[model samples]
Target chain A: MNSLSLSIIGFGNVGRGVAEVLYTKMPHFKKKYGINIKVVSITDTSATIWDQEAINLREAIETKNHFGSLKFWGNEYEVYKLDPMEVVKEIDADVIIDVTNDKNASKWHLEALKRGKGVVTSNKPPVVFDYKELVDLANSKNLPYLFEATVMAGTPIINLLKEEILADSVKRISGVFNGTTTFILTSIETGMTFKEALKQAQTAGIAERDPSNDLKGIDAAYKATILHHLAFYPIDFKEVHIEGIENLSEEEIREAKKEGTPFRLVATVEEGKVEIKPKKVYENGPLAVSGTSNVAVIETDLLGELMLKGSGAGIKETASGVVGDIIRAAVSIYKYL
Target chain B: MNSLSLSIIGFGNVGRGVAEVLYTKMPHFKKKYGINIKVVSITDTSATIWDQEAINLREAIETKNHFGSLKFWGNEYEVYKLDPMEVVKEIDADVIIDVTNDKNASKWHLEALKRGKGVVTSNKPPVVFDYKELVDLANSKNLPYLFEATVMAGTPIINLLKEEILADSVKRISGVFNGTTTFILTSIETGMTFKEALKQAQTAGIAERDPSNDLKGIDAAYKATILHHLAFYPIDFKEVHIEGIENLSEEEIREAKKEGTPFRLVATVEEGKVEIKPKKVYENGPLAVSGTSNVAVIETDLLGELMLKGSGAGIKETASGVVGDIIRAAVSIYKYL
Candidate 1:
């Protein structure tokens, strides 16, 4: 049986989550998918741990959880303070799993694809900002550059669009793309101040410490831009019109509620235009997703309207998507007799 | 660029719809997917037209719609008065698309798979009754056996479950699998008697001429059985417990409505059990899909709960799903370098 080697970049929550899933689901993956996955290298901002032989993933996970870095590894491992590009160039791996939130990681992804390595990532920068270049590079190389966790986490929006609905022409896509903004908006709808809702979301780990991208519609814009590129057109991220929830007033929310519409931060891509704005939606409409849930309503000529709803963000959810993409990439590699 | 060949095994509404899609989406498929798909053979109950150089799909669709048969073609095709198995064995094609309602089509599917041809189907019997055998044969031969239209038409449930959510453990699946029954049930809810609702559904073409399968819960049971096999356990169709709306009186429906619960023909599969019963669901619950819409609520351990909703049945919708599966099969064949 052939085994696939994986080098993970950024051992953060998503990276460790993939490691945990790969560790726990090893037997199932080998038994069912007939593909063995080995973590050969794992790199973070501080250190990069590489081993020609498979790394001790369990100890590495524990080391990262305890010491917050890969520095606690024993001397048996070769540790180097290498950047993402250096590791991408040097790693002897079949696939590069990019879970880094670094904005500059798109260069590393392109480098990896150019090196004939399959790329699976939960990172949004490469896909949202550099979709055409990365996708063209991957297509030119006949490699898989999958990012199922980038939009809607493990909800499988990208896979659904590309693989399942391949023959249908998607006319428009509108949905709740940002979970943090949706959480805040839903909390505000329940009579909480915007500040209180934001604090609660941050306390619940839904919002990050530096949550400018999430709060100011940049995150939603990135998702909308990615979806637009995949579904309809290859509209750039900067080209998408964006409006955050900061300008939405409580009086407007109350007024909309009285008129039978509820406020929701919706990301819409249609007719060569993409935008993320806080709009009033009908109460029972598909876009009126509450809480931290995300939903995408895709309109197609053949399939009419299709809606997919699921948990937008979680460690296990995003990891499930990334690992699923790993299996898909592996299957694509070994599909033939 | 290898072009794939298809042999369709029906010329009814769905078959014509598939031809229409193939004719219109040919350029899109060639440009986007980089594959050419040709309909090599088309068979109906009356006649079989086999053309080695590929049939004029537009003309075939026009013939089916205008004259209702392939008799209009004057000797440009090989016409035979043969059974489906003969056609399956004789047709030199890469894939067999079964869109017939023939109960004995499973034998033809088995023969086609045994002959090493990929099978894409909208027909349900072959999947409902002989899923294990057909799937095992396809797997043993490494050929594709896709039936995305069998359960939810163009909704992409099967792909979502098998491919996208492959890494997650699907705990349970509950859904409204039969669109005709749902349409009838919704009609009954809107101040119509059971017979009146069934008549209305038949008049609206939502219910078939012989709607026993739709009314007696057989359709939902078959879908539940298929979903159970795909999601959890491979429970046989006979093993699934079924309860139809024929037994539920108008008084019971009114009583349930008074109690704030709406009657829905829910197909539920959980913990080694599958059942399609007329249960009273909450007004706005996940399983409360109105009219002809189909919704599947999949409970997975990793991604928590996921819901997918779309049009469950239509000529173009089901054809879109079948064509999508055909593209998927073609892509799988061409994935490896």
Candidate 2:
């Protein structure tokens, strides 16, 4: 059996985490599944390195750790300072993992798919913005273009909805799809102001420096859009009514709690429509139980209702999703061959 | 644009439920995805009916309500008393939905696949006993042999693990995979004796009269086997360490409760090994929060940990999963064509 050659397209937190998992589990994966996975290439904005014979994963990790760039790991490997697009095309790899923080790299994922390379992404934008086109492309090429880390990090929402929950039709999809925003909202509910909550989230590493997306519900909206697309049900995000926690006052949160309700930021898609907003959930509702832990309630005509709950973000959870996609892609290739 | 011609192989709870969902949601599915799905035939042990043209879904429901069989719906369709194997050959269906209680219909499903017909089943025996062969047949024929409604009703556990949660390698898969046994265990934890708990579960339709498969943990083991298979990771049931709630005492359940722990029947697969048993879970553990709901905790080397929770069984949930599979299959076909 031919070994699977992989290229890491980004050297961000998630990319590094994926590398760690692959390296740590390499021996076990090889022994159990009878497949050897080698990181043949690594590309960042600054540099690219290719070793078609297979780069030593540990050596590369150490090089990245000490020098913070592949430039110093100057082995006999082919190294180039090239653009991301060129690196993606030139890398002799069977799989390209797009862990770029740049949401636009999602488009590059499509390009990789077009070139007959399997794509596993943590980037959500291209999928949220152009799900149909990408899915169509992957299907046309008979390649797996997966985005398990796109929604709720390690939580299996995408797979859960598309494969397991093959719902007759989704009646309502609502839950805390964003962890940063949920943490901020929960902080505010505990009497902190919006800015104070944002600062607290930042301190806790939950919120990014630019918290616009999280606060405005754009992040959750993107996740919802991708989920709707994967469900093979069309939903227009523009028609999706959204109300972020930014506008909610302390009084409202208190009042809701007094009424035996909790305010939760929920992203919902139903009847070909999508909605992302803050809603007051009653005591018995799934959203009410979600709390700070990110959760999703997928209600379908057939399945009645199902909820997926977990840490929606963080190095471990996000890396886990990426690794799952990698293993899946590897197995798929093994089966195909 | 060709219409999907389907035949119901068993007019049981799941078969009827699939029909109801398809009938009710046909319009929306057509309007949204532009796919026309029509049931052309139906069969049970007593009789079989076929129509070259579309069968009136509403009329069929009405007839079944009045006469307790779609076979007596009158001269609008061709009705015959035939064996299941004969019906599998003569239905002229693009997909055969096998909802038969027969656990030995692996042959019938394989026969359908041999004839190049797709299969959507709620039957467990075929897949549980001979999944590799069934999958191979489906692959050889380029047809979908789906059983989304088999294990977790409509929760989509199989699809989720197979397609979405593709970890670099699944380190561990543990969960309350069986709803009936979980219900029984919950009852016992809530102060009922083992026999009384089993009786209550049966009364509530959560347990079968012959609940050995569930109580003995064989049902969960089967599901675990299926999960490991779909994930393309090798796991053997015999190699799995198995334990069940059958050996639990009321005092143990009470003592666990006092210590803020709950006893859950969990099936776990890790590092290519499998284990299915009843285990005590702390309050903060994922299983502790699972409650009466059927939940699976999938731990991967990459994706970290994720939990899926929902109505693990019921006609509606199971049918929903089947419908989801139908939609996915349609999308796949559309792309293929």
Candidate 3:
């Protein structure tokens, strides 16, 4: 109960951030939750560094940073060519931290839960598609399956709603869910053309090489679906009505800005619907957060309007969420055991 | 394990709010937390209503509404002429909910903890004065003594920070803690004089009869002490430097408003210090919240700044927080038992 082990299923930037954060806040977690989290297995797509006797996260991070990957850090014998499936199935750990940031990690999440290990995921597909099934499995086993970083990275929409679970029912939830689109839209409001805004967003690392996912509202829709499931009811991903910001004309953006109701990619989750579309945000309401800051308005029956705002993206910011869920998972394990 | 009995020590507005919220959310809590919270005993200042079985909270609320008090609702045999102390000492309950907003309930909180009963409180005296001693005693007995409403009244500042505990170190916590003062300041920013603004606030029922506690910054300083203890270290009530807004000049307020940095009575909790004063809030940041909204900016090492904003005043809102803690206490008691 003093310590719990984890298998980090991805060794990318987010995985490294999680390691660095746990390294820095190990004492804090131990003091607060009375549990220390240890990463027993670290995995990249190709290879993994596994140690039953907890891996030194700092060393693993350094090895990855210095050697480019854990794949190249250790000798062929030390770094096994094990994929996420094998690692999730065989690793002796209390929780599986899925930071793969891809749909491919969805199966690994279910496998970890099936093996009676808790799961803390930053990945979205597992939650988007299997929201009820995954939660039911975890609950049946008295384990915690959390996806705090799926919707708003470290902004704590999911975690806050969990605390709001027993107290009240969520009437409606609306927010600016994706930071990339928010950045691009914000840049366009500053008189930049859509093309110039997208280019600047790419240059600033805010948009990906292929940013269609963000521009098409796919990312925001996924988050909206996850929130809809948590707050209201489980919904089909395809049922979400999505209209992306890619169609926003520069003239329309300027007109909206002139009217003081700047365009934002708003995601709304109601009783049985999830919608993501570019619309004019409230001039002075909770949805008026500027920059890449994410903001959510939860309309509850008891507490009228609750606003949560924070950074929606960034490695350390996201790791703040994953690490928070990691502690919750470990505490759950310790308490149950 | 399926039911948790409670002793509600105050039957005022907030107390009735808690009862009504619990009554409305009974099915929700029973379904979510797998526990039914029953009010075994309820007490106002002058009289007590004792029921070994669950009391109908809606009926009690109706009784209070129909009559001036619970004093005339039940028969003499049903309602005893007992005060808070007698009820707290002899009540058969699992948790004691103290909504008595006074210094006298301080001793009742300690006595409840001494009797091994978990406490969910909206009262501030126990937290602002004897935080460490009360929390230490609760923890020493593996009981949860949560005071979520004592600071922001269901704003979830304390709850959110508890989730953020293991994730990052809180560098500083700054917020608009007093809603009455916030309402007054916001009114003054609309070109009203201080006297006129205070009168407006009083007419709106936002300010109390003797509003010195809020005008003198005493309430904000109390909240600052609680936040400092939760985020940084335990601090003395006298340690917080306070400044009242009663001395604010209409000219100075207008100047600050004209400068675009609106005046707000901000409460800040940093390492080893808590400060409350009427200062200019950032025009674009989290503290820019208007009206009577309670907003807190938590500067964390990992996630930058996390902002939580909600209604700082209201009955149902405060009950949302107190009921949240009651469910948490019930879950803890169920798990430990």
Candidate 4:
């Protein structure tokens, strides 16, 4: 059996969600790829647990969910009050999974890549801020740094760009890249104020408590920047011109609907320029994704227009992307091993 | 530098289209993957050309287009009067590219897989009829048998299934799998009879000379069978219940339109059962693709629902799928090497 060690740097919903999947699907993965994966360490913002022996993933998830830390998981673990990067270096793992939604995870990602650890991340900071540097490091080390969950959760956007559409040049990409904003906008379309819609989204667990990043279009801009790097060229997140839906009125949305259109938080990358803003879209067009659904329409030269739509955010969907990347990295490791 | 020798079977539109892409995108592929691919042999239905050295692909495409044979291009090639299976054994190549549109290539695909050659095909018969045998042969040999072009051309349907959605259990797959039938149906919606729409499709280069398979829903059934094998379990093509668009009248289409629905030849696979039939679809549903476009909506347990849409079939689109598979095979080969 080809066994690989894994360390997850977040005990949040997505982090625990991936742990849950890896625990349940471990046998399936092993049977499919001859890959036996064991989670050895988990680091959250507050505490880090390291066990050279395999951690009891079920206990870890349960403890984390109930007590907000893996330290209370009945004492088969060593808790370290250390930084995420320190825990990353200390853990002797083959792959590091970063589900931490923080800018500090960027440095840890680079550190993991530098230490020849394959990294699967759902966070977007590392990719948007240091795409060229981190990707170059991963390539230079022949390590996989996959963030399939960053853009559209597990909807297969990055894999589509990297694997399937290599023969065709993508000319334009436009879609609702942010599901929280999309949910908010759709709520506004039904006569809710922006504040009420955002509260509703938060209550529905679609929007984060601190959803300023989503409302200000920073999340979409970061996703667009990532897409730009993967599909077109390397570009900084700051370079992407952004316009948020924070200021849009219900009256404005109603007018668009009355005119037979709907306001969508459209992220467009055309001719190397990236923009994420609200725009009126045709009712039946590809970008008219409803609720919290994320959609991307890529106009390619040879294959014409391709659209991908799916659940953009949620614990299970994001965990699916992270686990997919882990398996992908493991398969690649299997090939090269 | 990693290099591989390629052999192409069936010098028809899709074969020639792949050749054109391979010729034009050589530098790009080489630069990206360090893969130097050369077409060493090409076989049409009537003739086969064996060149120990790399044949000039441009001249070969032109010769096949003008004179209907590669023999007219030069005398430096060896002409083989052998069957495709014999040629598969004779060829010293890494991969066999099958673009033939006949059941004869099914034997060739099995033979190539048995001979330890990676087979990348746009042909659907081998996959539909002898899917289990061919796939088992390829798997046991640890060789790739990629037929991404068989379904939705270069729209990345198979890659999405194989690589991206590994974590989710797919419950249902519904799609507009055939572009010719989609075009014909949409034309019928515009007040044309099925015969007139098929003629218009032929003139528009969307329908083939003998489109009985497409009209009788065999093509869509084949694609759905392929999808079933990829996404769900293995089932024979004959197991799919098929109902084609051959008998649909203008009045039926008009009635559907009046009922605020469109007639789409939907390929549906649910709970190990397959159905390909012309059915009424909601205007904005995933299967309600129009005008030579293909769409697939996969319902998964974890990822919720995912929809993929793109150009279903065309020379360039199918060629993109073929080349994508070639590159994918080469990358896998590179890792193993």
Candidate 5:
């Protein structure tokens, strides 16, 4: 069987979840595609670990979970305090899975693409910063650079466009793209103040310690930037107008609900523009998703309106997209390369 | 540049839509995939038209629209009363595009697969009756047999499961799978009897003249059978327990709406069983679609729940799925073969 090698950047929740999935689903993939996969390297913030004979994925997950870093990998394994880019230059793999939220992650993503490695990522900043450049490089290299988890993690919206909707032109895309904002806004609708809902979301690990990006609609704008680039044209993430949910009062939400519309932090891409702001959606509309669930309603030329709904948060859900992208890349590599 | 030839079986409304999409989107595919596709032949029930130089799609569409069938081909083209199976045996093409509702369409499908041609179709009976056998043959020959339009037209649900959910196990699928039933039931909710709503649907061309299959839930059962085979296991279409909306009155539908649940003809696949029946859905549920829309909610192990919604009818929409599948299979053939 042909063996596929993967190097993972970021051994955090989503990264660990990818490992867990690859561990469990390896057999299924091998049986299906006549290919086996190996994790050759894993890079965390502090250090990088490498095992050319294939890293022990379960042990790697356990080590990271117990000690918060890849530096704590077992003594027998070769773990070094190497920079992530250094690991990218040294380790050899067919694909690099970026699940980090680091600003500099795009550096390694570009470097890997330049080196002819397929890039599969759940990281948004890398895509938001370098979508066109990376896609160009990947096309030049004849490699697959898929970021299915970048927007609406694991929901396959990106794949939906790339694989299925190519025959039709997408005219507009409106979505509840941020989970943190959704949690806060929906909580406020149930009588919780914005601060109280923020605290609750932070307590539930749904929001970061500093949820400024989500609160300011920058996160949704980032996702919208990537999707807009894929669906229509490339625009700098800064070009998207941003309006956060930080100012949404419970009274305003209740008022909107009284009027039979609910306020959602919606990101809309239409007519070559990206807009992120709180918008009133009909109660029965496809964008009326509750809880932390994310939804996208894509209006197309021929198919009219098509809707996709699923969680855009959580480790496993994100990993599902990342791993699915990896398999997609692997399948292409197996077929063409 | 590569050239892909397609032989279309059954030049009905869907067939003409495929021709229209291909005619309009040829430049897009040629630019993107570096492949130009041509329809080598188009067959109706009465006759088949053959042209290796590519059938004039616009003329074919106009001719079929003006004339009752394809038998009235222009004097410039080669037309004869050739059986569809005979056309399948003689056509030199990379793929067979089946858009017929013919019960024995699977015969041509098997013949095409046996002849090493990839199969892409909007036809359901072929899949419902011969799913496992056809899939096994396609897998053994390394060909793609895709039927995305068989379920929700061009909604891409099948491609979602195949390309995105391979790493996870699907636990269940629940969908409002029939457009006729949805149109009739939702009409009844607006204060119409079953017969009245069905008559309105028939008048609107949403229901066939003999709407027994749709009124008996057999159409939804056929779709559930196909999805169940893809998600879990293979079962005969007859095995699905079907309950149509024919017995429901306007009072029952209005009472359910008053109680906050709306009646929907839902096809549910869970625990290796396919059930098609009218059931109560929460007003805000994903399956609670209005008009002739179709919605499917698929639950997987890692991704929690994912939903897809779109029009399950219309010539353009169904043609979108069929052409997308044809492109998919053509890409495979272009890449590996």
Candidate 6:
């Protein structure tokens, strides 16, 4: 069994986390599933590293820790400071994991699919931008283009809705699809100002440096668009109505609470239409119960209603999702190749 | 793009319901996923029916409704009252669905694997009896021997544990795996005696005619054995200390409620051992929240704890599981074959 070689396109928090999980759990994963996974190449805007016969992950980790790039990790491996597209073609990889923040990485992903190489991504921008084209490319090539870590970090909502719970008809899909906005909204519900809540979310490592996307519901809207597309129901990103937590006032939050309801930034798709907005929901509603913890409630005809709730974002959780996609892709490889 | 040819081994309630779902959903499944699923043969202890083209599902339904046996449908192709093993070899089926009540069908399933045919079953007997052998045979043959309907009807517990929630070392698997006991116990909690509860459960289609297995906790024990095996843990049925909902006094039930807990017959596996017995759980606990509905809570090292709750047993729900497995098997066929 040849090891499934992986080339990571980014070296950010999640990309490094995937490397760490693969390194730490490689022995266990091999022992259990007969999967010999190797992160053979890595590329970032700053630098690139490539080793055909498995790079020394320990050295890479240490180099990243010390000099912040693998370019100065000595002549043990082929190194470059080229663009990601150049690295994608040069690296002898079976799969290209697009973790770059570039919104146009989705195009690269499609190109990879066209080149007959599988694409697994954690980047949300690509999926939120051109999910249909990506899906079509994957389907055309009979290759898997999985983004398990995109929407809800570790939660298997995509697989759950797509494969397992094949609902005859999906009536509604509603949830807290954004962790940053959820955290900020939760803080605001607990009497914090919008700026104070955003700061708290940032301090908690839940929000980005520029918290505009988190505050304006754009992140959640993107997630909802991707989810709706995967559900086989295409809804335009612009058509997905957005209402952010930035406008919620202390008085409004208090008033909603007083009326036996809670203010939650909810993203929903019902009857093919998408709605990504903050709405006051009563205690009986599923979104009301989902506070800081992210929850996805899928209402279907056959399965009736199913709710999946858990930590939506983190290194461990996001890495778990990526690793899961890796395993699923491995299973497909085992079956197909 | 060959149509999925199916052979149902038991023409019971679940079998008929599965037929209904297939008959209704085949067009949609074919149009969406390009899977033309057709039940080619059906067998019961009383009679058997086979048609190479496709069985007249409407006529079979009418026969089952009128004569309570599929015999009255008249043989358009081939029909017989043969053993399940004979059907396994004789029928030109891509998949054999064993919904038989026999606890020893595991052997038949293994034989099917030997013949290079896929098996989807709702019967828990084979899995509970010898899981390792069945799993190994299926793996060796590169065939799917799925029993998603075995543990929790339509809850997707097995798939949820296996594929969706990729747990890093599942710490414990516990749930109300038996619906009859749950229903009886719930009735007892609602001011009914054990005998009255059992009677009501039978009337409500929750309990079987021979309810000894459920009342004595053996049914739940079987499910626990299967679950433990699926989790890749070595747990023998004999090692699972069984204690059912039998012989519980009304005072015990009342006392349980008084302490803000409820008496639930739980099948639990921890540290590689199995324990099936009734336990008192707090109101916030999964078991407490799961009333007559079946619930399974899986605690893993990475994913923390996850709970899946839904209707435990019913013709429709159990049939939903069978159909879900069918769809999955179809997808697998598309990928692998």
Q: For all the predictions, what are the DockQ values?
A: 0.79, 0.48, 0.65, 0.75, 0.72, 0.42
* Proportion of native contacts kept per candidate: 0.84, 0.84, 0.68, 0.78, 0.72, 0.22
What interface RMSD does every candidate have? 1.0, 3.0, 1.8, 1.2, 1.3, 2.2
lDDT of 1 by residue, B1-337 (tens): 7879999989898998999999998999999889988988888878888788889998888777788787665555667776678888988988999999888788888988889888999888878888888898999988999999998888899888788887888888889988887777667666888888888888999998899988889998888888888886566677789888888888888778777788889988887899889999998678778877999999988899999999999999999899999998888776541
- Per-candidate TM-scores read 0.95, 0.79, 0.96, 0.95, 0.96, 0.92
Segments in model 6 whose C-alpha atoms lie over 4 Å from true places: A66-79, A282-285, A289-292, A334-337, B74-79, B165-167, B334-337
Q: Give per-residue CA lDDT, model 5, range A79-103, as digits (tens).
A: 8877778777888899988888888
Clash count of each predicted structure: 0, 13, 0, 0, 0, 0
Task: Name model 5 segments beyond 4 Å from true.
Answer: B249-251
Q: Which stretches of candidate 3 lie over 4 Å from their true place?
A: A75-77
lDDT of each: 0.87, 0.76, 0.85, 0.86, 0.87, 0.78
Better of 4 and 5 by TM-score: 5
lDDT ranking of the models: 5, 1, 4, 3, 6, 2
Error of 4 at A125 (Å): 0.7
lDDT (Cα, tens digit) per residue for candidate 6, span A137-221: 8888888889888877777777777778652556788888777776666677778887898788778777889988877888888
Predicted candidate 2 versus true structure: per-residue lDDT over B1-337, tens digit per residue: 6788777788877777788888888888787677877788888767877776877777776777789976687774677887789878877877788888797898889888999788888787788778888888898878988887776777777777666654445667777778777677667777888899888888888788899988888888877777777664545556767787788888988788778887888887766666788888876666764434777777665455666777777877777767777776675566555
Q: Which ten residues in a row have the lowest lDDT in candidate 2 chain A?
A: A283-292
Residue A142 deviation, candidate 6, in Å? 3.1
Model 2 per-residue lDDT tens digits across residues A1-337 = 6799888888767878888878887777677667878888888667877788887777777778888887787566667886678867877789888888786776678778888999889998777777778888898888988888889887777766655543455667777788777676667667887788789889888888999888888888888887777664555667667767778887887678778787777787766777888888875655764433677887766666677777688777788788877877888788777
Lowest summed lDDT over 10 consecutive residues: which window, candidate 4 chain A? Answer: A69-78
Give one digit per residue, the lDDT tens place, for model 4 in A298-320.
99878988989998888899998
Candidate 5 residue-wise lDDT, B36-106, digit = tens? 79899998987888889899898988888899888888987788777878888987988999888998888
Per-candidate TM-score, chain A: 0.96, 0.92, 0.96, 0.97, 0.97, 0.94
lDDT of 5 at A318: 89
Task: Evaluate residue A173 in candidate 4 and report its C-alpha lDDT on the 0 to 100 scale.
Answer: 88
DockQ class, candidate 3: medium
Q: Candidate 1 chain B, which ten residues in sequence have the lowest lDDT sum?
A: B70-79
How displaced is residue A126 in candidate 1, in Å? 1.3
